[model samples]
Target chain A: MAAANENITADAIEATEFMELSRKYRVTGVPKTIVNETIEIMGGLPEKMFVRQALEMPEE
Target chain B: MGLLSPQDEATLKNHLSGITIPVQLVLFTQAFGGSESGDVAKQILNEVASLNDKITVVEKNFVLDTEDKAKYKIDKAPAIVILSDGTDTRMRMYGAPTGYEFVGLVEAIIVAGTAVIDLDPETMKWLQAVDKPTHIQVFSTPT
Candidate 1:
């Protein structure tokens, strides 16, 4: 997504390596994504579904 | 010892053969008071760079390079900033790129090297339509 738009910046962080951040974000499981520091995705979903949820778009 | 096997190197080299433009991986690592992952990250990046001529690794001191740290808005040690043809891709990796993290790094590199995002058209549209600044942080374990 970051490549698609200049306004988007994506960071892939290792949960184990950044324990403080992981705890701060309440990452209890692997593959947890936090967008804008609010929206939380628990697990990996389909590509479209993941993108929609990450962007906070309404489901169609 | 190198991390990649001979077959892996050949395959990775072939995969990276499509890269026509230069991709620079700017790595920030603290010399002191840093985790051992910094060394791991450096070694991994060097291994990847060795496979492709168009790829280069640029090292930065996380403590000393204050300007660069601020420029990339890096708040932690062992951060990787990917640049495509001297332009910021806004894609970053934190911690050592090992296990599954290495796969993510390779994919990011392909995106940077090819300038192509292999997303669904609809997804691409949505992503391109993003006007506001969006910061996405994905947290995952090595396994």
Candidate 2:
């Protein structure tokens, strides 16, 4: 997503290395995606689903 | 004493062979008061860069290089900024790129180097339509 759009900035953070950040985002599991600090995705979803959630787009 | 095994290096080199443009991995690390992961990250980056001529690893001090830190918006140590032909890709990896993170790093490099995004067409449409500043942070363990 970040690659396709200039407006998006994506960070892949090592949860174990950054304990404070993991705790702040309440990331107990792996692959926890937080978009804009508002949208929280607990686990990996399908590509389309993940994109929709990240963008806060309505499901079709 | 490279991090990647012989077989892995061969496989990775084959994968990186398709890259047509330069990919600069700008790494930020604080030598003092930093965790051992900084060294690990450097090793991994160098190992990966060794396989591809177009890929280069550029080191930066997190504390001393304040201008670059600010330019890249790096707030932590052991951060990697991916650049495609001197342009910021806005793709960052924090902490050591090991295990699953390693796969992601390679994918990001491929995207940056090839200018090819493998996302679905519909997904690409949505991504291209985004007009606001979207900050996405994905938290994951190395294992």
Candidate 3:
């Protein structure tokens, strides 16, 4: 996503390496995604679903 | 010891063969008071760099290289900032790129080097429509 758009930045953070961040974000599970510091995705979704949620688009 | 097997190297090399643009991996690591994973990350990046001539790994001091640390906005001990043709891809990886993380690292590198996004056309449109600053942080474990 970040590569596709200059306004977007993506960080793949290791939960175990940064326990403080993991705890701050309440990342109890793996593959937790935080977008714009507001949207929280719990697990991996399909490509379209993940993109929709990450971009906060309205469901069709 | 190399983590990737001989077969893996050949396969990865083939995967990276289409890279036309140069990809630079800037790795920030602290020498002291840092976890062993920093060393592990370094090793993994080095191994990956060895596979493709178009790929280069640049190491930086996490504490001493304050300017670069701020430039990349790296807050962790070991972080990788991917660059395509010396331009920031806005892609970062924290911790050692092993296990599933290794696969993600390779994918990101491909994106940086090949300028190819495997997303659907509609998905690409959505991504291109993004105008506001979107910060995406994905947290995952090695396993």
Candidate 4:
């Protein structure tokens, strides 16, 4: 997504290695996703679902 | 000792062979009071960089390179900032790229080197329509 749009930045962080960031974001599970610090998605979802949630678009 | 098996290295090299443009991996690591994963991350990046002539690894001191750290807006140690032909791809990976994380790193590199995003048509439309600044952080553990 970051590559698709220049306005977007994506970061993949290892929970165990970056404990401070994990704690700050309250990440207790693996594959937890935080979008703009406003949206918290737990676990992995399908491509469409993940993209929709990341973009804050209403379900279609 | 090398981390990747011989077969895996061959496969990874094959995957990286199609890159047309240069891909730069800027790594930030703290030499002192940092986790051992910094070394692991460096090794992983070095291994990947060794596969493709177009790929290069640039190391930086997380503590001493304050200017570069701030320029990249990196607040964490053992971070990877991916660049495509000297341009920021806005993709970052923290901690060692192992397990599934390794796959993600390779995919990101491909995107950077090719400037091609392999998203679904509808997803591409949505992503391209994003006018506002979006910051995405994905948290996972090596398993």
Task: Provide the overall lDDT of each model, using Cα atoms, as 2-decimal numbers.
Answer: 0.95, 0.96, 0.94, 0.94
- After superposing candidate 4 on the true structure, give the runs of residues whose Cα lies further than 4 Å from its correct spot: none
TM-score (all chains, Cα) for each model: 0.98, 0.99, 0.98, 0.98
Instruction: Estimate, for each residue in A1-60, the C-alpha lDDT of model 2 and write its tens digit.
Output: 898999999999999999999989999898999999999998999999899899999878
Give lDDT tens digits, candidate 3, residues B41-102.
99999999999999999999999999999988888879999999999999999999888899
Q: Judge candidate 3 against the unseen true structure and give its global Cα lDDT, from 0 to 1.
A: 0.94
lDDT (Cα, tens digit) per residue for candidate 4, span A1-60: 899899999999999987888999999998999999889999999999999998889989
Q: For all candidates, state DockQ relative to the true structure.
A: 0.94, 0.96, 0.93, 0.92
Q: Return the TM-score for chain B, candidate 4.
A: 0.98
Candidate 2 stretches with Cα past 4 Å from truth are none
Candidate 4, residues B1-143, lDDT tens digits: the string is 89999999999999988899999999999999988999999999999999999999999999999999999999998999999999999999999999989999999999999888888999999999999899999999888
Q: Which regions in candidate 3 have their CA more than 4 angstroms from the true location?
A: none
Strongest candidate by lDDT: 2
Model 3 residue B124 distance off true place after TM-score fit, in angstroms: 0.6
Residue A13, model 2: lDDT of: 99
True contacts kept of each: 0.93, 0.99, 0.92, 0.93
What TM-scores does chain A show, candidate by candidate in order? 0.96, 0.95, 0.96, 0.94
Q: Candidate 1: which stretches are off by over 4 Å?
A: none
- 1 or 3, greater by DockQ: 1
Candidate 1: the clashing residue pairs are none
Predicted candidate 2 versus true structure: per-residue lDDT over B1-143, tens digit per residue: 98999999999999999999999999999989999999999999999999999999999999999999999999998999999999999999999999999999999999999999998998899999999999999998888
